[model samples]
Target chain A: MSGFSRFTPLVNALPSTIPFVGPEAIERQRDVRVKARIGANESGFGPAPSVLEAIGRTAGETWMYNDPENFELREALALHHGVSRDNIAIGGGIDGLLGEIVRLVVEPGTPVVTSLGGYPTFNYHVNGHGGRLVTVPYVDDREDLEGLLEAARREDAPLVYFANPDNPMGSWWDAESIVAFARALPDRSLLILDEAYCETAPAGSTPSMDALIGQPNVLRMRTFSKAYGLAGARVGYAIGTIGNAQAFDKIRNHFGMARISTAAALAALRDQEYLRDVVGRIAAARERVAAIATENGLRPLPSATNFVAIDCGRDGTHARAIVDGLMEHGVFIRMPGAAPLNRCIRVSVGPEAEMDLFAQALPKVLSAVR
Target chain B: MSGFSRFTPLVNALPSTIPFVGPEAIERQRDVRVKARIGANESGFGPAPSVLEAIGRTAGETWMYNDPENFELREALALHHGVSRDNIAIGGGIDGLLGEIVRLVVEPGTPVVTSLGGYPTFNYHVNGHGGRLVTVPYVDDREDLEGLLEAARREDAPLVYFANPDNPMGSWWDAESIVAFARALPDRSLLILDEAYCETAPAGSTPSMDALIGQPNVLRMRTFSKAYGLAGARVGYAIGTIGNAQAFDKIRNHFGMARISTAAALAALRDQEYLRDVVGRIAAARERVAAIATENGLRPLPSATNFVAIDCGRDGTHARAIVDGLMEHGVFIRMPGAAPLNRCIRVSVGPEAEMDLFAQALPKVLSAVR
Candidate 1:
């Protein structure tokens, strides 16, 4: 267990805690293969066929480094969003970008704001940089925008994170409220507006790109990992002002991107028709999940995302048992980490076959847990 | 150009700079196709056919996120290196790992020691993390171990970087000197023994895995980018004590790895015979590159890497002219970023056709520069 003893005090004080235990880890630990992979909010329906073809065609070019500037990918992203490429910064995924964002703004003991039970990965990065966390609990299972703003101003915090169509709880705020919240934040506080689940959110739930493009304090994160079904591709981008985007260049691993993944993203963007078609499928699947939850005597939250949160009618332990019990049947799902939220179990949309597995297992798990 | 006005003072002071300009960018900027494609030190020979087959087959699974634990790949690498899986920490590439290492130990204004003409990307990471650099110049084209040690102790720098079979110069020190240098460092000073080229070095040039395993202050980095011919795959790992390796779990993008790339690394590791064969080709290409340099009346430095550095007879201007001149003929190559290292033009080992093009283009470019 000997480690370099001279690691910066911040690094030395941090514990090794992963944000999520991947389903694969569960398979290995429990010696059970997952049949319904729905826990991570990945698009179980997969990316378009054209993307797979692109990866196959580009496999031979795997020896050359990807363009560090990511010119083509950024241009495509910009074109899709009607913004300039200079306003885009690409990284391995939103997770990677979050780390960079945290590093750029957080000095030791700097107060950063986020909702309690928000993205653990962001909190991990903030803590890794020795930034003090000042969290506002979710209001009615939705991120408390007003509370977050109050905390940021009170603490004079330089960074705040807001996620629309939030994870775990599957709740969302209207676009106008979100825009108002962004405009009301102090210019001193940088806002990381994570729209990772926006593709699957209900209409009007996400602000238009133009609404926040001019705000230097706002960086909206988008990823191909969710509805695009390329979670394994590890492609994500942040849309911000040109100068804020360029800040990433100061410290990012210029050659860190995988060439084929870039190709996959390019292909994914080109196949927007497939994206539209899959978004429909995702909506249908979410309804199916909701229906299953309703039949199981659980209260399914109204969702603006690919996942639905089912109130398990008990404490955290009850939700935990149901999550573990479903996993025993190879039907994998997850629950929120912190209290009140943990009373619900989260289920992601998948194909009918996986949905059937979840349907069959949920009733049995509820019965067993009860 | 608007950016958040409240970024930490350290971030505001940093400039936007990339360590390396990729060849694709060169093609776009210079309005020319890279026919020879020997720039950036990427292997033009490409990955093995078997690895390509693996990527094609696994491309269908692009929907699932890579294992956050990287269990399978780490186990395979562990077996290959004859160490426990806990001894390895996976990263995007050596460049990515360097950034992480710098972040783990460096704070604002922290002093870091490295060779003056060493990898610009590593220095870029140190600066990105707000560390002040303390550079030791190369002696006889090799990184000065004594000077580095002296600087580290004098400045009480917590981090020092040394690359065996160094880049831009293709020079190396013997195993005995490397081991002695690692052991001589104060326990508080962490040595980054970058062995990115170890697979292609002379048999005794690299210390054995067990040589410095007991040193808590050392971490050796290896990559699949060079001899494994998977530069675009973005797979690299660090070898160190269990505790040191686990420390990465505290902050790394656990799910940032692309699934197909992990498959590519596993296949490449399992097919070491292919790697052995490719290393042979790389060595042959090095010799071919050296002969080409000699034919053009330049002195080719001895290389243990998949690239050769040819010292131009004049100054940095002469080297720059040759690099730019060769590009005019569709022969893409690069040179060191600073003098006296900038007096040399670097040519990465590639397929026979590319070498033929380099052989043809060099004399013409050299003559034109003259």
Candidate 2:
């Protein structure tokens, strides 16, 4: 247990904890091979054939480090968003970018605002930096936008996080409401408007890029992990004003990008037709999940993202039993960590085979849990 | 130019800078294609065929995020190095791990020590964390061990960085000397023993894992970017005491690793024969580069790494001219940034074709410069 005795006091005080336990670890711990991997909100339908081709073609070039500037990907993203390359900053993933954004703003004892149970990874980053968390609880299963704004104003918090088409509950706010919320925040408050599930959201749910591109206090995080089906590739970008974007350059690991991953992202970006087709599949899978939940005597929440949160009609313990029971049948799924929200189990959209497995396992798991 | 107004003063004071200009950036800025990519010290021999196969096979799994724990890779590495899995921490690469390490140890005004012209990326991380750098100049192009020790003790610095078989100058100390330096440092002074180039170094040059694995003050970094020929894969690991290793989990983006890159690293690790073969090729290419330097009447510094630094018989201006002139011929190479070292241009090992291009371009560039 001997360790480096000179780590900063902040680091020493922090616990070695993972924000989410990966499905692989679950499989290992449960001693059961995951027959249906519908957890973690990963796109089991997979990336486009063109993206796989690009990855294969770029395999030979893996000896060379990726361009540190990420020029090509940024240029493509800029063109796609109708902004300059300076408006975009690429990172390992949204998770990685969240850590950087937190580091840029949070100091010891700094107050930061987010939903009570929203995005544990962001909360992890905040706590890691010694920032005090000021959480606004979800209202009607959606992030309490007004409460977040109030907390930011009252605490004069420098940072706030809001996820569009949010995880766990799979809830969303309309583009107009989101824009209004951003504009209402204090000038000193930097809002991380996480749109990780944007591509899968219903039309008009995601705000237009131009709406907040000029706002220095707002950053929109989008990822290739969801609709593009490349979560494993670790490609995510933040869009903001030029100065806010450049702030990432001040502290990011310049040579940290994986070359093949970049190629995969570029190809994924270019093949929008495939993305469109995959989005269709994801929506259909969501419906299938809802049907399965309803048939199993659970209430499936309305979703704008690629997952459906099923209310198990009980408390967190009952929901946890369902989650653990599903795993026993080799069907892996996750649940929210906070009260009320934790009364439900979260299941991601996957291929029909996985959905079928979930359908088959749910009744049996529920019976056992009951 | 407007940015989020609430960034910490440390971030505001920092410049948006890259430690090294990538070759791709040079090509974009200068409007030239690199015919011979010999810059950045990346292995041009490429990763093993088995690794390419692994990548292709794993490409379908890119939709899923990599395991947060990186359990399999750690297990394999632990087996390879004769250490327990708890002794290792995985990261995006050495570059990403350095940033994490600095965050764990450094805070505003914290004093950290390193060679004056050592790895610029490490310096960038130190600066990003607001750590005050205490530098000791290289003695005869080798990182001065005694000078670094003295500076750490004088400053009572908590962190020190030492790169063995060092970069830019490609000099090395024997294992005994390295171990002695590590043992002499005070308990509170944490040492980052960067061994990124260890695989290409001469046998017996790298200390055995058991020699320093038990030391709480030392963490040795190794990478797939060099002799493993997977720079683009962005996989690096740090070896230290179990508690020191777990420290990374406190703040690292747990799911940041690219799944394909992890597979590639695992495959590369399993194919020891490919590594052996590539190491031989790298050593041979190093010799060829030195011969080319000698043929052109430049003094090639003796190197144990995968690159050679050639003294140009003049100052920084002359060396810059040679570097720029070679780039005009589509041959991309780099030189050190500081005095004395700037008199040397560093070239990475590559395939025979790239070597031939460099061989052909050197004399013409030299003649033009002269």
Which candidate comes out best when scored by lDDT?
Answer: 2
Which residue pairs collide, candidate 2?
Answer: none
Give the CAPRI class of candidate 2: high
Candidate 2 residue spans exceeding 4 A from truth:
none
Local accuracy of candidate 2 as per-residue lDDT tens digits, B1-370: 7999989999989976779999999999999999999988988889899999999899999999999999999999999999999999999889989999999999999999999878999999999999999999999999999999999999999999999999989999999999999999999899999999999899889999989999999999999999999999999999999999999999899999999999999999999999999999998999999999999999999998999999999999999999999999999999998888999999999999999999999999999999
What CAPRI class is candidate 1? high
Candidate maximizing DockQ: 2
Model 1 complex DockQ against the native: 0.87
Best by TM-score: 2
The DockQ assigned to candidate 2 is 0.91
Error of 2 at B97 (Å): 0.9
